[model samples]
Target: MDETSPNIEADAPPALDPAQQSLSEALRVSFGILKIVMVVLLMAYAFSGTFSVGSNEVALRLRFGNYVGSPGQRVLERGTYLAAPFPIEQIVKVDTRPSTLLLEDEFWFETTKNDSGLTRSQLQFQKAGPLHPLRDGSLITGDSNIVHAKWALTWRITDPVAYLTNIGSKEVAQELVTLTSQQGIVHSIARLTADEILRGIVNREQMLGLIQQRLDDMRTGITIDQVTLDKVSAPLRVMRSFDAVTSAESDRARRIVAAQQERARILGETAGEASEPLLDLVNAYSQATELEDPAHAQEIETLIDTALLELKINDSVIGGDVARVMNKAQTYRTQITEQIATEAQSFSQLLPQYQLNPRLVMTKLWEDAREQILTGDVETFYTVPGQLELQFNRDPEIQKERQKEQLRSQKKAQEDAESNR
Candidate 1:
């Protein structure tokens, strides 16, 4: 041991203070927390690019101000999607739900609101002054008549890319739609009369098609759901006159409809569904006859006769007044034929008797005739061998009785005819 040469223990480094050690440990923990916070922030930034599209919404993704993906894939449907956040990628959402817009004053008269929240036009007999070109709006009809109308438009975006690129916003799209619709209305109304416009005789579908065509040409990418004419009329000053005309027109239409229905009913009752064809055939036959073409007339008459014969043979084929008349005619013909046949048979049977006893046969026939005459519906009076110049004046009471009996007989005959039919 060389104690006097050197001391190796004395050359060792000194122990750190407790405070510095504690500070060092704290610094390490702070760095670990900061790293964790930075990771959380980065995750948040990444997830911020996630978006959810609703059922009625369409989304488009653009990278560096230019559209991304293929044409079909450019538009995103209802789902969740992710993209690079912020300046690297941008998302545009378009609502595809149907929206309605009412253009009330575009072609409507200037109106003032009443105390009850109703417009002046809604009130009865509210007069309006001369048109103010700056304030009031109106449309000129084909007849150069002034008319007013209010319209409602329902639309929705069909193509997201076109709508976003062309229209860009709802405000701008609404303006375009309004302008286009106004132009369409002006053009359509200019081609129609005021009466036609008020009566709804104007072709609304064609007008809407024209408007849609215009939109298509402009590539608006909007589909029209519907276009409704809410109100239409002349100016308030002539409202009463217009209303009178409208009411008259409505009455005329109703009367026309009723007359048509009555005509149909009469024709149906006359010959069922065959009435029209039968009438046409009869008219053709008449025309042919008027032309003095006997051959054509005869041909048409034969066809008509064949049709009638078929109808008579099969009553069920046509159930109408014509069928009933035919049935009655056939019954009368059958009765007359049967009567003639019976008389002929009886005469044949009585020929030998009459030849043997002619006087007796004559007396018997006279008695039969007298009996039939007495049993008939006439009032019989027997005056014995009178050339007495008797005045023949009908008794009122007897005439009344006879008339009643005749009416009863006619009613019975009609009932029997109907039953047979």
Candidate 2:
């Protein structure tokens, strides 16, 4: 009885069979399941969201609709990171990539007239609260013609949050751009004529920037890249009048250019005419010198040229040059005489062109030299019969000898005629 009672140990609860072991394992599994549940509760955190930021993107985290923190200039390059979800924290993704968008504004166009005499149209005159187009509006021209214009604007969002928050959405930004641009263009068009706008690229750009300024004042974070005229279509009713004005401008430009060319031609002609008298004087002076006119010669021409050149010609040099030239002329005359006497031997080859004998050729040349040496002016042509008669009287001996020969020839002719009789 003592040994059996020792077998029941106080510290040991039980010695189970296979059924007990199976029951213990089932309880163990239950405890492990409970531990897994606690771990899941600890791991699944609430109020967290994911951030997918690209290489050029940044995420601005907000808490309770207020700015909590924002990524710096460099983007949070890794994509899809978890963050405190919305309501506790909200993440706004911003694109830093270069981008652009274009928007066109709605504005008033041409109108129809009513009995009230005001410009009106069914589309523009119809009232739709704030959405009605304007009528009787005008567009400024470069050349003062009333033009109709519409614009296309291209812009970029430089700051995404600022753009989204301030401008509201891409749709709202577009609407503001269109409206602001229309207002600016219309106001500027009032200051100019339609023709001015048509011919100007730079002017249109400046006006577009003015429109952008209107939106920027509202703190819209959009940067206008450019503004362009989409079209300058005109009202069909005023086509002829505008065409007439453009034609007049073209005519004015043509006439102005023609007048300038004519003026240049006249100036050139005047310069040419101004030099003609000097050329004539030089030619006349050359002919006189060739004839050995005593008052006009190459020395006098040289003196005149030196004076015109603003150079000095002293009396000693001028007188010495003239005397030396006269002496040289005489020596030249002797040599020419010797040559002519030698050439007179070739009568058959030389005399036929002149219808003269070799002796007559020499005699004619001698007379020409005599006229040249004594003449006060150029040339030795006879003009009237009386002057030729006077010239013959200067040689009395040759005349008397010719008269005696005429008498002898006449007597001899009479004797021969008597023999024939």
TM-score of each model, paired residue for residue: 0.83, 0.47
lDDT of each: 0.85, 0.60
For candidate 2, the per-residue lDDT at 134 reads 48
Compose the digit string of candidate 1's lDDT tens values, residues 4-45: 977777887777899999999999999999999999999999
Best by TM-score: 1
Compose the digit string of candidate 2's lDDT tens values, residues 1-421.
6665665467687778999899999999999998999788656654237557777666666678876644343224447767676668777776555444333223334434543364324332343223223444445454555555556666666666667568656668767776777777777666665565555543766676787788778888777777767666344455556667878998999999999888656533332222233334466688887787857766567655663333223321222223334445667989999989777765456568457566787887789878778675333345665534444324566567778989999998677544432
Best by lDDT: 1
In model 2, what lDDT does residue 255 have?
100
